[model samples]
Target: MIKKLFLLVILCSLQVAVAQELSCTVIVNSDQVNQTNKQIFKTLEKSLNDYVNQTKWTNRTFSVKERIECSMMITINKYENSAFSGTIQVQSNRPVFNSTYQSPVFNYQDKRFTFNYVEFAPLYFNPNVFESNLTSVITYYVYIILGIDADTFVKEGGTPYFKQAQNIVNLSQGSGYAGWQQTDGNRTRWELVDNLLSNTFKEYRLALYNYHRLGLDNLVDNASLAKQSIAGSMKLFDKLNNVRPNSFVLQAFFDAKSEEIANVFSDGPKVDIVKLKETLNEIAPLYSDTWSRIKY
Candidate 1:
């Protein structure tokens, strides 16, 4: 009996340790990027927070009330055409507890059980170079990394939010520089941004379809389907790249999604289900991708 008691204590202590080890935050390195390009950083930051606040899946409900610490590290790459880009790092200390519970057996056999570990998925995003293309790049990363339900929100009349995001891109128009509406002659740079956004919407739809067809959550599972989906997206990316490969923001936007498409299958293309799992990763969470950028 004493041995069982000791085992229980050990298990409890282990749980505490595991919980303590799970810490997450977002870091941005803005070393060389300046105040004039601050809008890009702001847009990225908003998308990151929106992702955590809105994403649902995981079979575990995070404490929305609990404050999760996040930061950003921004740096200017002088060699890359004085390009401005940022990386978003997310760490979570709070244990994303599994809702599944095992019955407490006090006298059955004095048995001890090992703690089960849950896997966490990482975030990904590429920085945009051009101010005009920044909006599309930022928005794409938010959807891919943060898992925003862009289609549902947009279809639900989230016009105000979409327009606000558009405004961010439009701000850089004219004055001898490319704007959202301005034509760069044969360059078709603006057209590329528009195409990028259009392609992103398609990918979102594909993600939704895969989520529904295969009962999985996070990119850790069902990577093959993600690959196939991304492969299709690449066709679009290539077409757009041909138009304005020079646009850093545009190039990064497609590159980031391409990476995500590859990682979504990082855990392999299979989800666990003995018999009763939702047809489409039932725990799939819904997040409003445009809340930060849109007014409505």
Candidate 2:
């Protein structure tokens, strides 16, 4: 019985060690701040790195290799007393099946991030409650990453995670924070989550699932069929754009996928080139230059 108990404890410890969902790198840049003591930024970077990497954000157990790959770059624009104002660039990616390539899932820059932090202080976050702005913002993006990664694997699988992010935005309302309100900007946290969860943009989410799983994942097995599927998925964006012209979600999708779409079709059949160019230009005229590189 003692031997069995010892083995059980070992298994539990192993599970705990491998359960975190994100493998994220956090950078704190304070070059814009004219401060002599820059050690605080270094401490902030390490603290955020530990907070994101070590914290378990989901119930699903993940092996070290399966953790979601993501990054956050915080550029401290100004420092006054204990308050810091900065912009955060957040990005996350997923590995394409049967390939060494990774696809960008989310890439956004939040310019209104302002927070208060003390050197060496622990960063704390609770999904149900609004805590410090620093932790809340980090946690919000973490769920967004998880949601987008899951949606690529399963249809609308990101709904719960997006809802979790919405809850963070809801709890943060009236906190006087810059990015939590609908009026903050077109690309505010509230608007992003709202569009993801709304039925009006359901096609956008479905297109993401088809684009990644049905399309990209099958390239190694059948390039022609995969390209066809990816082009079909791109058509869904036209539907989304028609419903809401130039929406933030539509722009965000193209922002992450423009170059990828070009590279994927850079050497495809003549039929695919015609179809892709027509559909892509119709939906994303902003990427005409990038798409022009695709050869028939």
Candidate 3:
């Protein structure tokens, strides 16, 4: 019995060590870069995939089925020497309760994402320290994605994770990276995390929890109430837009959700969508084209 218990402990330890949080697909696009050596991009893609997938990002041990689904597409606009200039579009989603359908949670592009890379240099994540711009950017988004996912499950559950990303932002400041400083563009990473954790944007975070946990997760039980909850969640933003006036966080929210919102209300059991549409147009006028798809 003693030997059997020892073997069981060894197996459990291996499983805990091997479990990873993110099942992220990393893509490197070099079409814009004029380089005959395409092998470097492929190598970089493989390296990034390995780095992101194999890393133990959190203290929580997640089963393989519980891993977060996300993707990162890096478009290399220019590559010269060992320096690479590009944009990274990061997106993530979560599974709905009692359903096979996955709900889209985050979708945003970092236009000022430029980073240096030496081919085959092993990537490491030191949360307390500032490393390469490439790793800092990637790690920042990983925490953001994790934070967003956590927010959907519990009220303000993502606070700790958002704080972690904030720490990364704090550490990376003045690293000569464009997206790391307050002076960087409004849509930069610094603004993204800062807005998320700010009380000024608290509605955005509440809406996230309501839309997912109370709305999508309960759709199978009572879609009418669920749709109403989702609409009520959007209504949380009515006064917010007036204050911030088309803020970066608001834009990012609509960017990821406009289509999904339209689809949810369009096909579901009718729920006073006329008022919902009005609210959507007022807050997210940029996605009015998508909002129009939601029938009265």
Candidate 4:
């Protein structure tokens, strides 16, 4: 019995040591709702916190420090009985190579988040099954975060994970959810992942890999070359824009990267400044003011 107990302890320790891929901070805000049963919100918060942090969403093993840092803020707009409706804001960041700074990879908001929650009920998610909209939506974004992080490491490394997210969308076709359908809007979850994985957007994904792994990661060793590599990657966005103008994916990229891109070129070689400004205007004309701020 002593030996069996020791073995069980070791197994438990091993399980605990294998950290999940995401170190997500989940917040359940109920300020919009006028309710006396605030305890349910507290319970929901704890449950979601556990669901996101404790569940293993990928096959890769990550150390506590290596886990991807992300946050999901779900603001409750309405709460009636066990039903909750709200919006979710999600943001994720990846650490730069050999630097203390982290770069934002994904920042998005889901304005239509409606679901039913039972107090103290378990939040279950299975990629093969379409369970609840809450779990499905959360799982979808989790995979998206993973996919974006993966792309920064290797060229198209996020393809498999994006496909996984696409599968969730496909399975959720009959889910009657707002964000799952293409007709919902161009910025819907379906369009985001679909554009990311589609051939028309291949250059954009390639640019992501180059911008991170080849450009940012090499900045410490060679700033000029890194800037040039990053510039080359930026040009690909122009190509992507030519193919699919005003794409949701392109807008999303700028949403997370505009500031960083501007800063990176603010004091670079004079030639790069001209090229970057022209490309920035051509591809992301929406951010011309931001790009114009870059020092020539």
Q: lDDT of each prediction vs. the true structure?
A: 0.32, 0.89, 0.89, 0.89
RMSD of each: 18.6, 2.9, 2.6, 3.6
Candidate 4 clashing pairs, residues 3+ apart or interchain = none
Residue 33 lDDT (model 1): 48
lDDT of 1 at 141: 28
Between 1 and 4, whose TM-score is larger? 4
Candidate 1 lDDT, 189-243, residue by residue in tens: 3443354355434443343333323312222354456345433433443444455
Q: Judged by lDDT against the true structure, how good is candidate 2?
A: 0.89
Model 3 TM-score relative to the real fold:
0.93
lDDT of 4 by residue, 1-296 (tens): 99999999998778657888888899999998999879999998899889988888878878777889999999999999888899999999998988988899888888989999899899998778898998888988999999999999988999889998999999997888788899887688899999989988999899999999999898888888888889998889988888888898888889899999888887745446777789899988989999989987
Write candidate 3's Cα lDDT for 184-211 as tens digits.
7678788999998999988888988999
lDDT of 3 at 28: 100
**Model 3 misplaced regions, further than 4 Å:** 1-17
Q: Which stretches of candidate 1 lie over 4 Å from their true place?
A: 1-73, 77-160, 175-193, 196-215, 218-254, 257-296
For all predicted structures, in order, the TM-scores are 0.31, 0.93, 0.93, 0.92
